[model samples]
Structure formats: C-alpha cells, structure tokens
Target chain A: MIPIKKQYRRLRSLLFALSSVIMFFIFWELIALYSPSPYVPDPYSVLKAFITMLTVGDIDGYTLTWHALVSLERVLLGFIVGAATGVPIGMLLGIKPTLKGAVTPIIEPLRFIPPIAWIPLSIVLLIGLWRYIFLIWIGVFFPVLLDTIAGVKRTSITLIQMAKTFGADNKKIIARVIFPSSLPEIMNGLRVGLGVGWMCIVAAEMIGGEPVGLGRLILKYANLLQIDVVIVGMITIGLIGLTLNYFILLLEKRLFKWRVEIRA
Target chain B: MKKAILLESVSKKYEVGSSSLEVIKSLTFDVNENEFVCIVGPSGCGKTTLLRLVSGLEPPTSGRILIFGDPPDPRKQRFGVIFQEDSLLPWRTVIGNVKFGLELQGYKESEHEKIARTYIELVGLQGFENYYPHQISGGMKKRVAIARALAINPDLILMDEPFADLDAQTRSLMQRELLNIWSKLNKTVLFITHNVEEAVFLAQRVFVLTKRPSRVKQIINIDLPYPRARLSPPFISYRERILTAFHEELEGI
Candidate 1:
C-alpha cells in the first residue's frame, strides 16, 4: 500500500498536470475569440469537426477511421519488412568490418537522400501500394541498420572473452552474448524508425492520389479552405504518434527491466 | 599430484605504434590438480595478461601454456574465467547468468535448471534467482559471477582480481566465502590480485611478480590451516613477507 503522504503527493502532481493542459486550451480559445480568423478555428469547432468526421460515412471518400486504418497498415507493413532485412545485414556488417568498409561508402551517400526525395523515382518505377511501401521502407531502413551496427560494435569485449573462456564457439557467442547485449540499442532504433516511417506514409499519401488515407483527407479539406477539417487531421496525426510512442516505451520498459538507474 | 596447468617461460609483448612493449618476460609456473594458487604483483605487472594466456583467450608471444599435459584451446578445454568487472549479462536474471556457461556448452535442457539452481544456492543467492544483476549489490554480483563460472563444472578456474572493487569488509567476507566454495569443489584455481594480504589469505602458494617486464620474483608457500586468523602472528608474518617482497620489486623499478 502507498503511504498517505505519497498518495497526496501523486494527487497534487496529477492536478497540476491537468491544470496545465486546461490552461493551454484556454489560451488558444482566447486567442481565437479575439482574432476571429478563419485560419485559427476555436477548440469547440475542431472538436465538433473531429466527431463529425468520425461518424460521417464520407470525409473525402471514406470515414476517418478507415483513413487512419489504411495509413496504419501501410506503416506497419513497411516497418516490418525494413526491420526484418536491416537487422541481419547490420549484424553482418558489425561482425565483418572489412565488408562494412567496402559497403559503407555506397550506403552513406544514398541514406542521406530523404525518403520524400525518392517520390519521383518511386512513382516512375512502382504503382499503387508499392509506392507507399517503398517510401516508408526507405525511411525506416537506415536508422535500424546504422543503430544495429553501432550496438554490435559497442558490445563489451570482456563479455565476449568470458563467453569464449566458457567454451562457447563463435556461433554460440554471437547468438547468445552479442545479440542480447545489442537489444537496447536495437529497440531505440526501432522506435526512431517507426516515427520516421509514419511521417513517410503520411507524406506519401499526400502526394499520391490514395483517396483513403488521413493525409489525403487533410489535403482535400485544405484545398477547399476548411481550416477546421485541417486542424482535425493534424490532431489525429499527433494523437496517433503519441499512442504509438507510448506503446514502444512500454515495450522497452518490459524488456529492459534489468536496467536500473544508478544513484550518486 | 598431477599438474593441472604448466606455463613454460611464457612471455607477452604488445606492439604499441612501432615499439614493442614487453609485459611478461620468461615467466614459468605450475599449478597442481585442485590447488588454489594466487599470483600477486605490483599493479600493471601483467597478472591479467598471464590469466588470459592460460585461458587461451590470447596467445603468449613466446613460450607455451599447457592444461593437463596438452596445449590449451578454449573450444576443446573447459576453463571458467571471472573478470575484474561485474561481467554478469545486464539482460539476464541471476539464474540466467548463472546458467550461461552450461547453456553455451550445450548441456541437456532438463539439467540446466537444476545445475544453475545448485550453484545459485552455493553462492548464497537462493532468494535472488529472479533478480537482475543491476538490482543486486556489487558483492552479490561477484557471487553471481562465481556461480556462473562454477555451474559449467570446468576443469580449472582463472580469476582476475575478482573482488578488487568491494569495500574492505565485504572483500574479507567474500574471501571467506570463496575459500569455503574452493575447498568443497576441490577445483584448480589460478587467482590474480595486487593485494598482498588477500593473496596470502586465500592461496596455498603465492607467486609474486616484479613490475613492468614481470616475471616471478618469489614463491612463498602458506602452510597455515583453513580459517586462518587475520590477527594471528603467523598470518601477520605471511602478510609481511609478501609485502616486503612486493616492495622490493617496486624499489628495483
């Protein structure tokens, strides 16, 4: 059971957090009231638009939930494919420095070319869903690969030496020691890659005539000068990003329960 | 007694930039079966390098190291090594880390848990089986390292200053615990440390080495019985003899 003082302290912090959020909305509402600009919709109008889009059968071509689900599918598929391929190649590069030295020069220049910049080439070479998947994959691949390589390189020499002394062959050492030790860094890379992949899917949807994604809906409404609908789209993206990040953090905490903060 | 390990004039030289820095020079020693031997030397006198050479983690620049009358090879011979650092895997629990060596050796899946549990209890970590290394104290982590080494049932154990990081009280307590474990297992152990008192307290014989281009300076046999008294005259005399020999090496440098 929590102590009474500790419970009171937690309640106080919660109240403060709630007040801060309330204060932000109040400030936005006041600004909207004084200015009365079409560009800056009041919070009530944005909330109303959000609900209406959720219930209505058509926002652009499909309901808001359908648009979100389509974008989620694209992001998940691209992220999985990118991670599945990137992690193994990264591990290979990490173990074989000579091979890494040969391949790095080519990858270094290509990775710098942003996923959005690949849109023209993707459009020319691919059609429909492949285009979206290609962009998202490009966005997700490099971070995971680079981070995995860095993680492998950072594995403790002492741990490897200890494993060897215990009669572990090279294969066993790599499978048991190197892989598990690099997990924290790999998870961090996945989190970063997920964010980048989500952004790429939204940007790709905006450019392509997807007709069923959140980005497409945002573009359609913005073109018609419906500021409230645009605001609704932005809020949806933010909420989804926040939710996905929260899940990643929860997974990290669960997997890395062994990590503890050292106090001075 | 059968020879558990023999080092014939083993030398280690590391190339730094263009110059070669000799670490161990013409060092030779032998440990008999089930003997607890400690190597004491001035800091940076290649004690760890010697342990690594015997463990076959690194080859000696010159001379030979043998285990049971054959040249040592890590893949073919079973040797457990405890490093100076708390080398427990941060991702695994106490039981998982203890079972690491057995798992690597491809022990039967059914036997792994029983063996790991036995060693965990042997190390007095019965209730901490599920706790991660980070959650345990430094002394406890060292115990886990010992348990991990013992779980494999290796032919010999090489330890490199395994308790140098603990406080004096904890270090003394671990020393006693280690002695108890060593006596019960009857395994050959090659322990390395710079602490003269610790070396005198733990080993049946202490091999003292000179600084820098290190070689055995003196070999002092400790004939004291088990549960040696630190305050007793014989214990103090043994400590003094090792300290004097060690200081002489320091002065020569």
Candidate 2:
C-alpha cells in the first residue's frame, strides 16, 4: 500500500541519519589528530589510550575498566534500591485515592527539587560520598512514582465500565484493568528516570571522592591537562548512556508488541 | 409474553453546581422476552445512560431497574451490553476479550475457553482469537464485542449504537449479522441509536426521544416482516413519523 516514493524517502532518511553520525565521529577524530594542543589528544591517541586502558591498565590513576565496573556497580545498586521502594509506593499512590491525597502534598514539592541538590545533606547525614547512590535513587524515584500515578489515572473510563458491566467487582476491575493499563506509562517513567539517573552519575562521582567512573576520570585528566583522555571519558559516558537508552527502547518495543502506533 | 426487562419509573439526576440535570426522569419501559426495542434519541439524551442503568453498571438516582421483575444484579448474569466503541481490552487477545464475561460468571477455565472459541467462531473471528484488539480492524473489534456479549448467553442484551461508527457497508452487514444471531437465539435486545433507518431495520418498536433532557416522544411499532425493506410503505411511514417528531423539536423551539 505504501507508495514507492515514501519507500525511497525512508531510505534517504535512514542514509542521512547514518551519515550524520558517522561524519560527526570522523570529524572529531580528525580534529584531535591535526590540532596542535597538549590538552586535546587526537582520535588515534585516544584509541591508543583506550587500548592502553585494556592492556596497560591505569592511564592516570584508575584503569578505564576499573572506573566502568565501579560506575556500573553504583548505578545498579541505586537503580535497584530506587525501584524496590518506588514501584510499590507508586502503585499505592495510584490505586488508593486516600493515599494519593495524603501523600501528594508531601511528594509534590520534594519531587521538584533535583536529586543532586540533596548531595550536601547526604554527606552530612550518611557516610560521606557513598550517599551519592542515595542521591541517584532520589532523582529516579519521583518521575517513576508520578508517572505511575499518571498512568493509572489515564486508564480509560470505558475500560472500567466494560469490566463492571461483565459482573466484575472492585477487586477484579482493579486487578484486571488498572494494573495492565498502567504498565506502558510505568515503563516510560522508568526509562526517563533512568536517563536522569545516568546523567546524574557524573554529579554523583564528582561530589563523592572517587578514582572510578568516567566522571571522576575526566576530573583527573583535567587537572593533568590531558584533554584527549578527558574527551575519551566524555565519549565513554556518552556511549554507555546511549547503550542503556537503546536497551530500554528495545525492551519497550519488544515486550509491548500490542502497541499499534498511530503512524504519522 | 414474558416480561424480560422492566424499568419502573427509573430516574437518574446529575447535580452540576447547584443545577440539577435530569437525564432520565421517571422513564419507564418493559421489554418482553424476544422483543427488540430501539431507543432513538439525539446526543446527550442519556440513551446510553439508561442502558447502563438497566445493565446494573450504574445505579438510578431514585428508582430501581429489574431483570424479570426483580432488582437487577450483574451476578445474575442476565444482561449483555455493547458500547458504541467496542471497549475491547487492547492487551487481551480477541478470545480473551470475549471470555471476560464468562470468566466473571465463575465459569471454569476449560469451559470458558470452549464457549469463547465457539462464540468467536460464530462472530467470524475464529482465526483472530489469538490476535490482540490493536492488531485487528475496527469492524472486527465490534464483532468481538458482540461475541463477548453473546458468549454469556444472557436473557436481555443492551446495545448502544454498536455499529454507528462503522462505514455504511459494514454497518448494514452487522445489522444483518446481528439479526441472524438474534433471530436464531431469540435474545431480547434493547438497542439505542440515533439512525432512523437503523432503528427501523433493527427494532420491533422504536421509542423516539426529544432533544435536550429528553423524554419519549413516540413508540412507533414496525409490524413488517423480518429483514424489513427500507422502501416498504409502512417502513417509510414509520421513518417519516419519527423524523417529524425530531423536526418538531427543532422547529417548535
């Protein structure tokens, strides 16, 4: 049914997208080579350092893999902790109107404040620097919670009516209707919150004294005036973020196969 | 004749900022077993709301609705409803949507599956049982909704413009298909729609309603044969009377 013109346009768009990304990286690599600056390392130098990190271990102080592993641990711990507490709480707020009314007043303002803003308090209250994970958890919790409630609210009124018309009681309606209806939005919130969590990794590492993480690695290179390694760290973080985002997108597109999008 | 559904002076009101909006006010009707009653009303006439009240989905403001002269209970499993939209659960496979009522009625999983399969096959959705609502076409979804309603085998079925949204061709096909099913099963249907031709085609009797806080204006009986031709003299007369009643609402005001 699709016209060949549309098919050709789609091909053009795909090629355009691929070339744009390829060119961006190629340009960055070229500039690093030709530019004469001690601070800025060329693409080849960065690759050498990357290879060195794999084989030679620590370039500045911490090994590249070492920082990656540590950052991975922190993210996992914080994400798990946030989800463990946040999911149930979101469900409660979503399902029980009384719970929402009582809790919304408290959660509303607290949600507006950034998680990184809590760094100063975390240091004061908990063990110094380790509280960064707690801060990341805080950042992720609100979006997931609010979006969950929003998702529950978005459940169609007709669906509730349909269930009830079929002799479904309150419990049956909630269990069968509200729960599934909220799944898509819950996933959306989780993905958005996670992106925030990853971006906040740098903030977490910077606040907490760490020889690990691309964030802290960059800070180390900045002091040494090795801008190429700094760019490498930035690229590394960007790649990791892209990887995580892609996985979330993949899960969304895969698991919710029932999604029939309104194609433009 | 067996009185299948009875609405005894049933009334429903909505309070909006010190103003009371009465959608159904002391409205009463009785549908005999195997009878087809069509409620024709303009938008916001609470045609759908009345059906919901009869189905036990919504309680009346001051009166009670009864299935077979007793207070209506969804647990009795006597009423089936098809909304304007199919309202099929997007997450559920077509068969799952059809089996919903049976499952609610406490039918065992195996028996439920058997019934669902039979009805989906009857409604021309055998191959689509495994397909989700989003995967199917709108007409197919409507058929599934009809199948879902019929799967319960209720004494009385309430339908609110079930095919109003479909293209004319599909709507005509559905009307014929529904009549075939209704004729065979002898199911009592209280159908609501604004389409005069549809009201004539589907119902044994059409109760036309006035616009804005409507009450029944006329109950025109169609005594023609099954699969009544729209071009018949009596059928056109009935349509004219209903249309005149509707026009009176606009012209008089």
TM-score of each: 0.93, 0.87
Chain A TM per prediction: 0.90, 0.81
Per model, kept true contacts as a fraction are 0.89, 0.55
lDDT of 2 by residue, A1-264 (tens): 989999999999999999998898799877766778645676778888777766666655567878877776777677777777777788778878898999878988997887668877887887754686787788778778888888888888888888888888888987788878888888888888787777777777767465778778877777788776777777778888788888988898876777676211
Which run of 10 residues does model 2 chain A get worst, by summed lDDT?
A255-264
TM-score, chain B, each candidate: 0.98, 0.94
Off by over 4 Å in 1: A1-4, A30-39, A96-111, A262-264
Candidate 2, residue A7: the lDDT equals 97
- Estimate, for each residue in B1-253, the C-alpha lDDT of model 1 and write its tens digit: 4489998899999999999999999998999999999999988898888888899888999998889987888778888888999789988999999989888877898998999999999999999999988889999999999999999898999899999999999999999999999999999999999998898889999999999898988999999998888889999999999999999988887
True contacts kept of 2: 0.55
Candidate 2: list runs displaced more than 4 Å.
A1-38, A59-62, A84-108, A127-130, A207-211, A220-225, A262-264, B75-78, B250-253
Best by TM-score: 1
All candidates: interface RMSD: 0.9, 1.3
| lDDT tens readout by residue for model 1, A104-210 | 99999999998878889989999888888888899889989999999999999989998989878888888998988888888888888888888776677856676
Best by DockQ: 1
